[model samples]
Target chain A: MWHELARPEIWVPWLLGMAFGILVGSTPGLTATMAVAILLPVTFHLPAMAGLAVILGVSFTAIFAGDIPATLLRIPGTPASAAATLDAYELQRQGHGAPVLLTNLFCSAIGGLVGVGLLALLAPQLARWALRFSSFEYFWLGVFGLSLSAVLTPGQAWKGMAAAALGVLASTVGWDEVAAVERYTWGRTELFGGLGFIPAMIGLFGLAEVFRSASHRLARRPDARLEIRSASSRALRTVLAHPRLILQSSLLGTLIGALPGAGADVAAWVSYGLAKRLSRRAQQFGQGCWEGVVAPTSANNAAVAGAWIPALVFGIPGDAVTAIVVGAMLMYNIRPGPNLFHENIHQLHLLLAIAFLTQLFLIPAGMIGILGFRLFIRLPHSLVMSAVVVFCVVGAYAIEQKWFHVMVMFGFGLLGLWFDRHQVPVAPFILGMILQPILELNLRQGLIKSDGRFQAAWERPESLVLMILTLAMILGPAMWHVVRRIVAGIARPRTSESSP
Target chain B: MFSAHPARTDETAAPGSNRGARGGVSEPTWKALEWTVVGCAVALTAWLAGGGRSALVLSPGDPGPWLVPWSAAAILAVLAIGSGIAGLVGRRSVGAPREQETPARPAGRWIVVLLSAGYIVVAPVIGFGVATVVFVVSFLKTTSQRWRWWSAVVAAVALTLYVVVLFEKLLQVPLPRGSIGW
Candidate 1:
C-alpha cells in the first residue's frame, strides 16, 4: 500500500477523478450513480489499480460534494445528502454557509477514513455476522429504522408518522414485489415500475425550494458572502468536540451500508435520525444545528466505504455505485469474493490503499469544490432561483426521457410545498419511501416462510433480538414516563409526610 | 369540514391574521382533511384485500399479497383517526385562536404556484427552451422590483442552453423535446 502511494501515475488520475466527481455531485440532477456510470468507460482504458482508484475517488468525492448544493441551496446533489439539507439550508440561511461546508468536508474525510479502516480490519468478520440475518431480522431492522423517524422529528410525532405512511403509500404505486401484480398504476405505462425516486426527490427538494424562494417577499441580503478563513477553525473545533458522534455515525453507516440493497442514502437517514435521538440539542436538529450536519455528512461518506464490504467479500453489490465497480472489476479479469483475496492479494491491497488515499485527497478536492461553488452562491436571488427552476426541470426530464417523470416532479414539488407549509417534516417521508419496499418484501417473505405463524419469526435468535429491539424502541419512552410518574408519586408522599 | 381557525379573540386583527392556518384553511378543515385521508387509505386497503385476481398459497395457511398492505393500512388508519380525534377535542376545549405572530402574504406563493403550473402545461406545446424563457422572464418580472426583461431573457436562454448541452449533448441523456422541437 505504501509503495503504491508513492507512484505519481496513481495520484494524477485519482485527483482528476475527484475533481470531475466534485462537479457532477454538486450539480442538482447529475448523481453519484450517474457520474460513476459516465466514468465507467474511461476507467476501462486504465490499468486495474488505476481503474479502481478512479472509482474509489469518484464515489467518495461525489458523496462529499453533494453537501455543496445541499448547503447553499436546499437542493441535495444526491439522495444521500437529502438528510443534511434541512440543517445545511438553515445554517446557510443564517450566514454559516462556509463553516457548514467546512464541517461537512472535514467530517466526510474522517468518516471515509474510519469506514476504510474498518473495512480493512473487519470485512470478513462482519460479513459472517451479516450472513446470519434472515428476512425476519431484516423486517425488524426496517421497522426499527422507521421508528427512528418518529423520535427524530420535532413537535408532533403523529405528523411525522403520517408523512411516513404517505411515503409508503406512494412507494406502493407500481407492481407488487411479491405477487408480481400491478398494484396502483392508475393505467399509465410509466407507473408500471413505480414513481422514479430520482425525479420525485429532485422535485421534493430542488423545485420546492425554488417555489419557496420565489414566494418570499423579502429579497435575499446581497452582502452575504462565504467567509471560510474565519469560520473554518471554529467549525473544526465544534466538530472535534463531537468525536463520539462522528465515530458512532461512521460505524452505524458502515453496518447499514454493508447490507446488500441498503446503501449510503439509507445509512445517512438512519444515522441522522439516531444522532437527533441521542443529541442533547435534539431540538436544534432541523434548525441549523452543526451536529445535524455532521452526523449525515459523516455517515454518507462512511457508507460509501461500507458499500464495498459485501462487494469484495461476498460478490454482492452493496449499492448502485458498487454494482458498477463490480462490473468494471469483472472486465479487468479481477473477480471478487473469497477466492480473489487468496489469488490476487496485491489487487486487494491496492484497493484498500486506493480507498485510504481517495479520502485523503478529499481535503484538497472538497476545498476546491467549496471555494468554486461559493462564488456562485453570491449571485442575486432572482438569477439563482431561475437557474434552480431550469435545473429542476432538466433533471426531472432526464430521468427516463419521459414528460411524465417531469410531471411527477411537479406534483411532488406541490406536495413538498404543502408539507413545508403544514410543518410536516419531509425527511421521515423520504425514509419511509426508502424502507417501504424492503419492509413489505421481508414481511411477506417472513410470513410465507413461517406458514402464517407469527411465532416463526421469533424462532431465529437474530430475529428475536431484532424484534425485541424494535418493541423497545417503540414502547420504551412511554413506559419510562409511566415508571417515572409512579416513582415520583411514591417519593412525594414520603417527602410531604416528613416535611419540616 | 372543520374550520382550521378557531373564533378570533381579537376581532380588530386583520382578516388574514392567522399564520398557523396555512392557505387560510381552518383548524377543523385540516382535521377533516386528515380524517378524509385516513378514510381513503382504509377504503383502498379494504378494496385491495377483497378484490384479488390471483391467489397464491405459499403455505397451506398463508395469506397472499393483501396481508402487508392490509396490516399497514390498519395501523395507519388507527393512528390517523386517533390523532384526528385528539386534535379536534383539544381544539374544542381551547376554542380560541392564538395571537398572530406574523402577517400572512399568500399572494406570492399562489403566483409562483400558478406560474410553475403554467410552465408545466405550456412546455409540451411550446418547446421546453421557449417555455422556460417565458416562465423565467415572467417570474423575475413579478418577483423583482428592478427586473430587466432583456437580461432575464438572456439569462434564461443561456441557462436553458447550458442544461441542453450538458444533459442532452454531453451526457447523452435525452431531454424532453416538445412538439415544437428544438
Candidate 2:
C-alpha cells in the first residue's frame, strides 16, 4: 500500500478525479451516481488499481461537495446531503456560510479517515456478524430505519409517515422483484422499469427549490463573501468542542453504511436524527446548531468507506456507488468474494490504500471547491435558479434516455411543492422509496424460508433481538413522555389543591 | 409622554376565532382535508384488496405482492384518521389560535410551472436547445421585473450551449434534437 501511494501514477488520477467530482457534485441536480456513471467508462482504459482510485476519489469528493450547495442555496446536491440542508442552510442564513463549509470539510475528512480505519481493522469480524442477519432481521431493520426517519422529522410525525407510505406505494409501481408479476405498470412499457430514484430526487429537491425561490422572489446579495480565515478558526473551535459527537456519528455511519442496501444517505439521516435526539441542546438543532451540521457531514463521508466493506468481503454492494464499483471490478477480470481475498489480496490492499489516499486529498480538494464556488454564492438569484432549472431538466433526462422521466420529474416537482407547503419532510419519503422494496423482498423471503409461519421467523436469536430493538425504537419516546408526566404530577406543590 | 394604550382592533386577534381569515383555512376545513386524505387512502387500499388473488398473486411460499402495500396503506389510514380526530379534540381543549397565513403569491409560481410544462412539451418539437432558451428567458423575465432582456438572452444561450456540448458532444448522452440538428 505504501509503495503504491508513493507512485505518481496512483496519486495523479486521484487528484484529477477529486477535482472533477467536486465540480459535478456542487452543481444542483448532478449526483454522485451520475458522476460515477459518466466516469466509469473512462476508467476502463486505465489499470485496475488506478481505475479504482479514480472511482474512490470521485465518490468521496462528490459526497462532500454536495454540502456546498446544501449550505449555500438550500438545495441538496445529492440525496445524502439532504439532511445537511436543514441546519447548514440555516447557518448560512445566519452569515455562517464560511464556518459551515469549513466544518463540513474538516469533519468529512475526519469521518472518512475513521471509516477507512474501521474498514481496515474490522472488516472480517463485521462481515461475519452481518452474515448472521437473515431476512427477518433485515425486515425489522428496514421498518426501524423508516419509522425513525418519519418520527424524527421536525413537524408532525404522522404527516411524515403518510408521505413515506405514499413513497412506498410509488416504489411498488413496477414488477415484483421476486414474483415476476406486473403490479402497477398500467400497461405502459416505460412504467415497467418504475420511476427512477434520481429523477424523483432531482424533482423533489432541485425543481422544488426553484418553485420556492420563484414564489419568495429571493435575490442573492452581491456583497456576500466567504471569510475563510476567521470562519476556519471558529469552525475548528466548534468541532474540537464536540469530540464525542464526531466519534459517535462516524461509528454509527460506518455501521449503517455496512448494511448491504443502506448507503450514505441513510447513514446521514440516521446520524442526524440520533444527534438531535441525544444532544443536550436538541432544541437548537434545526435552528443553525453546529452539531446538526457536524453529525451528518461526518457520517456521510464515513459511510463511503463503510460501503466498501461488504463490496470487498462478500461481493454484496453496500450502495449504488459500490454496485457500480462491483461492475468496474468485473470489467477488470477481478471478481469479489472470499476467493478474491486470497487470490488478489494485493488488489484489496490497493483499494484500501486508495480509499485512505482519497481522504488525504480531500483537504486540498475541499478548500479549492469552497474558494471557487464562493463566486457562485454571489451570482444573481435569477441566474442561479435559471441554471438549476436547466440542469434539472438535463439531469433527469440523462438518467434514462426517455422523455417519460422528464415528465416524472415535473410531476414529482408539483408533489414536492405540496409537501413543502404542508410542512411535510421530504427525507422520509425518499427513504421509504429506497427501503420499501428491500423490506418487502425480505419479508416475503423470510416468510417463504419459515414455511409461512410467523413464529418460525421470529425464533432466531438475531430476529428476536432486532424485533426488540424495533419495538423499543418505536415506543421508547412515548414511554419516556409518560414517565416524565408521572414524575411531574408527583412533584406538584400542595398549593395546587387549595387553588383548585 | 405616557398615553392610554390603544384598543386592539383586529377581530381575528381575539380568542377562539375559528373562521377562515387572512387566507388561512379554518380548523374544521383543515380537519376535513385531513379526513379526505385518509378517506382516499382507505378507499384505494380497499379497492386493491377487493382484487384478492388475481391482483395480489400469491405463490406457493410467498406472502403475495399486495400484502406489504395493503398493510402499509392500512396503517397510514389509521394514523391519519387518528391524528385528525386528535387534532380536532386537542384544538377544542387547548383553544389554540388559528394559524396566520401568508398572502398569496401564486402568479409567479404558476407562471414558472406553466413555462416549465410548456418547455417540456415543446422540447421534443423544437429541440431541447431552442426550447431551453425560450424557457429560461421567459421564466427569468416572468419571475423578476428587474431582469434585462439582453441578460436573459445571454444566460439562456450560454446555458443551452453548455448543456448541449457537455451532455451531447462530450458525454455522448443523446439529447432530444428536432428538425435543426444542432
Candidate 3:
C-alpha cells in the first residue's frame, strides 16, 4: 500500500485535505461535506490515489475534528459530535480534559484503521452483492435506524419514538427538497431553509448545556493546566485499556456507515446506545465514563470510512459527505457502481490504501488542533462561558448573517431547557430530524412505485430483514419479560415436585 | 410514556412500582411533562399536516410533501394519547429516577438564560460587537465574584475585540452595525 505513494504529489494533497477537514469540521456551521466539495476542483489534476487521498482524508479527519469542540466545549462542533459531547465533555469537566481528547483522538484513528481495514477486506463482497438495495430496502433501512432511537433513550421507548417524531416534524418546516412543495413555512422566507440545523444544534447541545451548568459551583471550576502535562501518557494508557470496546464500536460504526442514508451521526448514536446496553458499568454512561468517551469517538470516525462503501459500490451516497465525494470521483472520471470494481480494481485498492494511511496523519493533526483549543480552555470559568456564548452567537449568525437563525438558536435553547427540566431525551429528536428526509423520500417513492401498498416496504429480501429488526426492536423488551416469567414458572413447579 | 426526572433519594424503587410517585411528584410530574411536550408536538404537527398539501399533490396516495409530517403527527398524537391514558391507569417509568450529581443553582440558570436571550434580541439592534461587550460585562459582573465591575468591563472589552477581529476583520463576515456602530 505504501509503495505507490512515494511521490510527493499524492501525500501533499492528502495533508492539505486533512488540514481543510480540521478547519471546516471544527468550525461551527461548516461541515466535512463542504470541505470535500471545496477540494473537488483541485482533485481534477491529481492522480486517482491523490484525489482519493484528499477526499478520504478530509472525511476521516473532519469526523474527528468535530470532537475537539465537543470535548473541550460542551458544544458539538458537528452533528456527529453529538455523541462525543456526552462522555468527553463530562470527562473534560472532571479535570481529565486533556487526556480525554487525546484518547478520543487515538480512538478515532484506531476506528479509521478498522473502517479502512474492513473496507479493503469486505468491499469486493459487499459491493458485488449486498448493495442490491433500492427504495424498498432504503425505506426499511430508515425505519430500522429510527427504531434505534428506542435504544438511545434511557427512559421509555414511547418517549424516544415521540421525540423522534417531533424531530421529523421539525424537519418538515421547510419545503420538501425533492418535490419542492412548500411545507409548514407559513409564508416566512426564513423558514424555507428549514430550522437552521447549526442554530438548533448550538441551542440544544451548547447553550442549553451552558444554562444547565450555570451553577455558582460551576463558576469556579479548575482549568486543565496540570492535566495537560500528563495528557499524553494517560491518553495512551486509556486507549490501550479499551481494545474490545474500540473494536466493537468501530465495527458497528462501519456497518451503519455502509448503509445509505445513515451516516456518522446515526452510527455514533447507535454505537453509544449499544455500548451502554452491553456495559456492566452502563450506569456510569454520560457521567464521564471512559466507555462513553470511547464508543462514540471510535464509531463516528469509523462511520466516515463506512460511508464510502455505498458511494463506491452502489453509486448512492452513504451520507451527505459521500454525496460530494461521489461527485468528485465522477469529476475525475472515476465512475462508481456495480461496474466500478471490474473497471478499476487497482485504482480502488490504491484509494483504500490512501484512506488507511490517512489515519496516521490524524494523530499529529488532531493533537495540534486540540492543543490549540487547550489554550482557550485555560481561561477562567466565567470568561470561558462568556466566550462560548459569544462563539455561539457568532456561529449561529455566521451561518447566514440572519437574526432569524439566531432567534432559532435561542428558541431551541429555550426548548432544550424545557426538555431538560422535563426529562425528555433530545437525542432522538435530532436523529428524527436527520432521518426524516431519507425516510419520507424513500417511503413516498416506494409507495408511488408500489401503488400505495403499505406492505411494499417489506417486499424485498433486505426490507424483510430490516422490517424484522425494527419489529424486534419495538417488541423485544416486552417479549423478553414474558419468556423469563414462563421459564421461571416451569422451573418453580419442577423444583418443588423434585424436592417433595 | 414516563418521566425522566432524577431519582428521588436513590431509594431503589422496583421497576413499574409507584414508589417514586409515593415519595415525590417526580413520577407524575415527569409523565405530565412528557405528555405535555408530546401534546404540544401533536398540536403543531396536526396543524401543519393539515396544511402540508401544496399544489404539488400528485394524487390521493401520493400526498406529496404532506404525507411525512402528517403521518408523523398522527403517530405522535396516538402515542401521546395512549401513553396519557396508560399513565391515568397505572403504567409508569421502568427504572429508578435518573441520579443527578451536577450541583444546580435554580437562580443562576435563569440568569444565564435571560442574559443570553437578551443578547440575542439586542445584538442586531445594538451592533453585535457592542451588544457582546455589554452582555459579557454584565454577565461577568453579575455572576462572578472574582471580577469587580471595572475588571469585568476590561475583560469584556478584550473579549469583544477578539470576536470582532476574528469575525469581522479576519474572517470578513459583515456583522451588523447598529446606531452605536464601532
The residue pairs found clashing in candidate 1 are B2-B28, B2-B29, B3-B26, B3-B27, B3-B28, B4-B26, B4-B27, B5-B26, B5-B27
Judging by lDDT against the true structure, name the best candidate. 2
Q: Write the per-residue lDDT of candidate 2 for residues A387-413, one digit (tens) a residue.
A: 777777887787657889889988888
lDDT string for model 3 (B46-141, tens) is: 665557254565644554677777778877887777766665555545322354443344588889989998998888888988899999997887
Best by TM-score: 2
RMSD of each: 9.1, 8.0, 8.5
- lDDT, residue A437, candidate 2: 71
**Between which residue pairs do clashes occur in model 3?**
B7-B97
Off by over 4 Å in 2: A1-104, A119-123, A219-355, A483-500, B1-39, B42-46, B49-58, B90-106, B179-182
Q: Give the TM-score of candidate 1.
A: 0.69
Scored against the true structure, residue A451 in model 3 reaches a CA lDDT of 78
Indicate the DockQ of the complex predicted as candidate 2: 0.22
| Least accurate 10 contiguous residues by lDDT in model 2 chain B | B1-10
Candidate 2 lands at a TM-score of: 0.74
Expressed as tens digits, the lDDT of each residue in A323-427 for candidate 1 is: 567656877898766566667878888889889878888988898887666454455567666666676676667645677877888898898777755556665
lDDT of 3 at B131: 95
**Better by lDDT, candidate 3 or 2:** 2
TM-score of chain A of each: 0.64, 0.69, 0.63
lDDT of 3 at A24: 56
